[model samples]
Target: MRHKCRIAQLGLPADQRKALLRNLTTELIRHGQITISQARAKALRKEVERIITLAKDGSLASRRQALGYVYDKKLVHVLFAQAPERYGNRNGGYTRIIRTVNRRGDNAKMAVIELV
Candidate 1:
């Protein structure tokens, strides 16, 4: 019954899913890349792109919005400071997801999600 539903549940409750994405987004912004489950990478892509778009905006409201979602204030500041020059020419698609080998234990598909 997916119908018009688009959000991936990731088999987690709302709060946990938000927290997981928040952590992943924070680490991705901090390190510029991260390895994660394919499903999570897919989900994280949307959030990262949205946040970077906000950073690109570089408005006080947008910065506040990004700060609310991103856990690290310093990282948000850096991202906002750099986003315009780094991504000015680009419209969207701020991240790339490269499929990697399956996990050793459960065979879950893994992927490296990195900033473009």
Candidate 2:
């Protein structure tokens, strides 16, 4: 049984997966939207939501923590500065994934992940 093995390997080695996620997270935050595979979107949703949650706190430590995962310092600043105010009235569910057409070649499932 695959009990408690929660992390999605994403069919990549550990370092590569981490790098991919970090890049995706930065793009999502900077652009407020991204289109990718369904599996990647699902995995990224968890990460982005967690980062937004940290941003909601607006603490120094939280900012540092988010900075660690996110590559751009300016993006992290934007996240901590704007995200809290934007999402202050709400509880959670910062992002949404909308199903979209599959790729032409591989026919892979696709989705648009956007910040809500």
Candidate 3:
């Protein structure tokens, strides 16, 4: 029956999807860039944008919420504490997707997701 179900499965169950997004969010925030498939990059872009929108405020609640996903206090520190100042005045579109050559073996499309 699987009708009108539009949520992306991401080839993972709920808990695993949360964990996967959490880890991806952390690395993207910390390193400023990560490489992956187009589907994941798009999905992860949403999560990263959500957190960054919250970060623009620099409030305790936003910090806590970001921490809920980010997990690492240090990363949260850099995310909310520093990023706001750096990205202040900007009104969203905080990430970028740079396409790359296909992966050697699997021949999968590769993309570099980075924070702007």
Candidate 4:
């Protein structure tokens, strides 16, 4: 039984999956939005939100944690600097995902994931 298995494997091995999510999260933080496959967007949403939440903490430990996950050190510094002001009043729901048309070649459902 696949009960309570909420995490999506996304057809990738564990290492690849983590790498994909980490890269997606970094780009989302850098660009504010990105268009990607729906399944990937869904999985990426969780990671992005978690990192933003850590940024909200604005603590040395939280910053270190985020730095560990994010690929770019400079980007992490920028994010930590801006996140408090940007997300200070808000709580959670830092990202929004909007469904878009399917890809032409693969017909995969696509969506735009953006920071809110």
Per-model TM-score, in order, reads: 0.97, 0.95, 0.91, 0.97
**Per-residue alpha-carbon lDDT of model 3 for 12-110, expressed as tens digits?**
999999899989988898899999987789889989999999888899999899888897888888777777787897888999999999989999888
Q: Report the candidate with higher TM-score, 1 versus 2.
A: 1
Candidates 2 and 4, the one with greater TM-score? 4
Candidate 2 — which pairs collide? none
lDDT ranking of the models: 1, 4, 2, 3
Report how far off residue 75 is in candidate 1 (Å). 0.6
In order, what is each prediction's RMSD in angstroms? 0.9, 1.2, 1.4, 0.8
TM-score of 2: 0.95
List, residue by residue over 5-114, the lDDT tens digit for candidate 2. Answer: 99889999999999999999999999999999999999999899999999999889999999999999999998888986799998888999999999999999999999
Which 10-residue window in model 3 sums to the lowest lDDT? 77-86
True lDDT of residue 55, candidate 2? 96
Q: Per-residue lDDT for 64 in model 1?
A: 97
Candidate number that wins on lDDT, 1 or 3: 1
Model 3: how far residue 31 lies from native, Å = 0.3
Please identify which of the two predictions, 2 or 4, would achieve the higher lDDT against the true structure.
Answer: 4
| lDDT (CA) per prediction | 0.97, 0.94, 0.88, 0.95
Q: Model 1: what TM-score?
A: 0.97
Residue pairs in collision within model 1 = none
